[model samples]
Target: MTRKAAEPSRRQPGPRRDKEPLHCIAACGREVDIGTCVIRWDQPGSLVCPNPRGRSACTRHDPRLNDAPTLPFSRYRIHNPDQAYEELKKTVHQFVLHYDVCWTSRHCHQLLADSPFKGSHFYLDLDGTVYQTCDLYWKTNTAPADDGLGNERAVHVEMANLSWQARAEESGLHLLQTDAYRKTDAGWLLNLPAGRRQELRLQSFQPLAARAYGDRGYFSRKINGRTVRMWDFTEAQYAALIRLCRGVHELLPRVRLQVPWDPEQRRTPLDRLPGFSRFEGILGHAHVQGGNKNKGIKRKYDPGSAFDWGRLRRALSR
Candidate 1:
């Protein structure tokens, strides 16, 4: 009732080479040097194409040779897995080769350096003072009883003093501290601007007031043929006063100011007294003007002097 199907016969492969340096093709009988050829197919543990060219062979025995699969879709190709993988890695490396290219332009190098991820840094010395945004006084706040002193009695200078000290420290400003003015056992010494010591030496004339008043701070001398005033300190004037003296008088050009020190013993309150009474011997005046020399130069007074309107304005601005 049913026709029987024929059974297929199994084929065993030929003998293998014994220590041979080269191989030969099965169909074409072409000799393939070991260096130029590799194994292709296999059947039951025996090689089908004993030798294979780098390229696929011409179609004679290959049943699907005319329609062979290509790289993107191929499944049956006998490619050397090691060589194929190496070639893939080399292609990727060449594609990314620009990473190793040295930066020759200054701007490009700077751009690379500026990346925040790289972690680099530097610093600068920025200068100048930050002024208060608004004016403050006792009249503005009704915390105290009214006195004839008006706003002066209500004024608390401590806040201003504290603010200045804080800002100076935070900003790295070269402000002199109150402690620097306190009297020490050391002689009345302070820092001087460079070369001012030389200027002091060159203008060697002593002020007559120094001798007449018996004040260690008075140097009422003439410099560059111009009238000048000088003062001696009692350690409370602060060290910065010393530099200010040198800067205004000897270092900078054509700067004149009230004598920073006095032959007379003085305090900040001494100036507020009547006739400047308690300040009598403690305070001496210098006629800071160009006499025969700087007749055109004007006198500059200290901050709290009766004649110091300009100084008051400067303080208010600060």
Candidate 2:
């Protein structure tokens, strides 16, 4: 069961009122003083004064208006991939990866824009080009409530593509179409190949790349009274991912190569952990989805059973 990406919110631009002086357009309903307020356009075509007083502003309007000194990776990295890489080297402790599981890059961007969740530092398009959306060093709202790992400390990467079910049908991959597993108390535990699991574990780097689903779980859609978990990353995607990981490792030598999941234990080590700020490595969303002691369960499987970990490992090794 695959779900279509939500259409981007299209709000009609408010009429420009030049006669009125600029005020704080936020819901706070405060009149901004030009002498102290920092004026900027937060939403499209909406000029707003984020700071009404001389004090700090709210993040709901702009995330960058905080009092903290700017780090090297503070700027958006969309067009400057090299600069983004260099900046991330100085401060990034963890590199998290996620599949857009949506349609096009435009759709992915729109989804992120409308979502309450903060966008990832970089986005990998189907053509293998990596685009930066946010600062690598900035903490994001990707983590669950009170889970601790978020934009403040981790770097996130999103890969734009379709979900596993749609991709499998289009590509004629029968293995992914099989319904061999059942939903359990823990979640939908997938019976993936051991060889593939080993491959994923081996390719992981330190601190692990956290999957977005780790905290919130997998997004599922029901079809014909059956629940389906979808995730399909292409071979080209894997190649690009390997290159990205290698580049990250070259810059941050202290980062380890390891998955956060404990295959023997069949669970994530960070599930109940207080925070991920001190830990450094690469982990997937699946490793963090169930939460500590499986307290807050959302998704059970992601990067799904068909993700080609062996191929990724082989490519990285070469």
Candidate 3:
């Protein structure tokens, strides 16, 4: 899906009409107050989704011939913001998270823009800035899940993390000759290119893993029948993500600020869930897209082994 940028408003970027333009998550073309900073699609410093997909089947909210998943904003029609928001909240219930396998959110945005039809509603940066690329009313073809209906009911965030690709041995995609993170005195820190360092939203920030596994500074575990290893998210990322979760919960009441948990296993299962679509709340893309035992679809491992599910769960509990 390809998304045309939002039509430029005659008014300048500052102080958009109706929206407070600060610390909010957008829905139905308007901003709803959220916990952290969110750069909206219409704002000047926004990473607008290159291709925004419109689901034609959902006529309750929009019925303007919006079957095209790659329709430009101008082609899509929204009759009423009040009605569309209510319908959108009723229809959407899941908040799917992803590791973008990029060095930074800016880098992730560039890759998304280069892609033919790939897009996400939000992008969580290493420095803790959340970029809202498109309104939650639109669907991004980020994950089809197993039933191929995950995108239909969920909003998605592409957080910047290299995943297994950080290690040269495990990184087949990028062909990295060395590990992305350097063993600094402070612990493990993602080493970005000199030029790219200046691109971060937080100029003084250093992307360091909030926690380390053993002495390796990364964690390895079996997820989706495969060994997935990655460094923990930065303290800032986890903090920002928690706020984002709360913010999502605020905007879409059905999307609770909680992760998946198994009472029998006594741990959060890091694999494709059996009743994925039915389970509502915050979840990883891996939880939705990790194909079955028979292997009809390719397995997915992301928001990988290193993510702190327990911390997220504990925070959401409060």
Q: Candidate 3 residues 161-264, lDDT tens each?
A: 99999998999987889999877889899987777777787877899998998788899999888998898788988998888887777777789777899999
- In angstroms, the error of model 1 at 192 is 1.1
Between candidates 1 and 2, the lDDT winner:
2
Q: lDDT per residue, candidate 1, 1-318, as tens digits?
A: 111122111123476556642212111111212121122222121221111112112112233422322112123242343343223222210000001011111211233234421100000000101111111100111111112111111111100011111122232333634221122244323233233223221223221111111323223433323333322221212222222222212211122233223336542321222322111111111111112223332222221111222332233223
Among these predictions, the greatest lDDT belongs to 3
lDDT, candidate 1, at 81: 35
Q: lDDT of candidate 2? A: 0.41
Model 3 alpha-carbon drift over 4 Å, by segment = 1-21, 60-69, 292-297
Every candidate's lDDT: 0.20, 0.41, 0.80
lDDT of 2 by residue, 1-318 (tens): 111122211223576476543322111111112111112234232211111110121122234533243323323223333443344444555666666654433445666666544455455554444544332333444443235333443555566544453434433433456532324454433333443233221222111112224432334443222344454444445655666655444445344554454568654443323344555666444434444444453443334443444454455456
- How does candidate 1 fare on TM-score? 0.15
lDDT of 3 at 229: 85
Candidate 3 global lDDT: 0.80
How big is the positional error of residue 273 in model 3, measured in Å on the Cα after superposition? Answer: 0.8
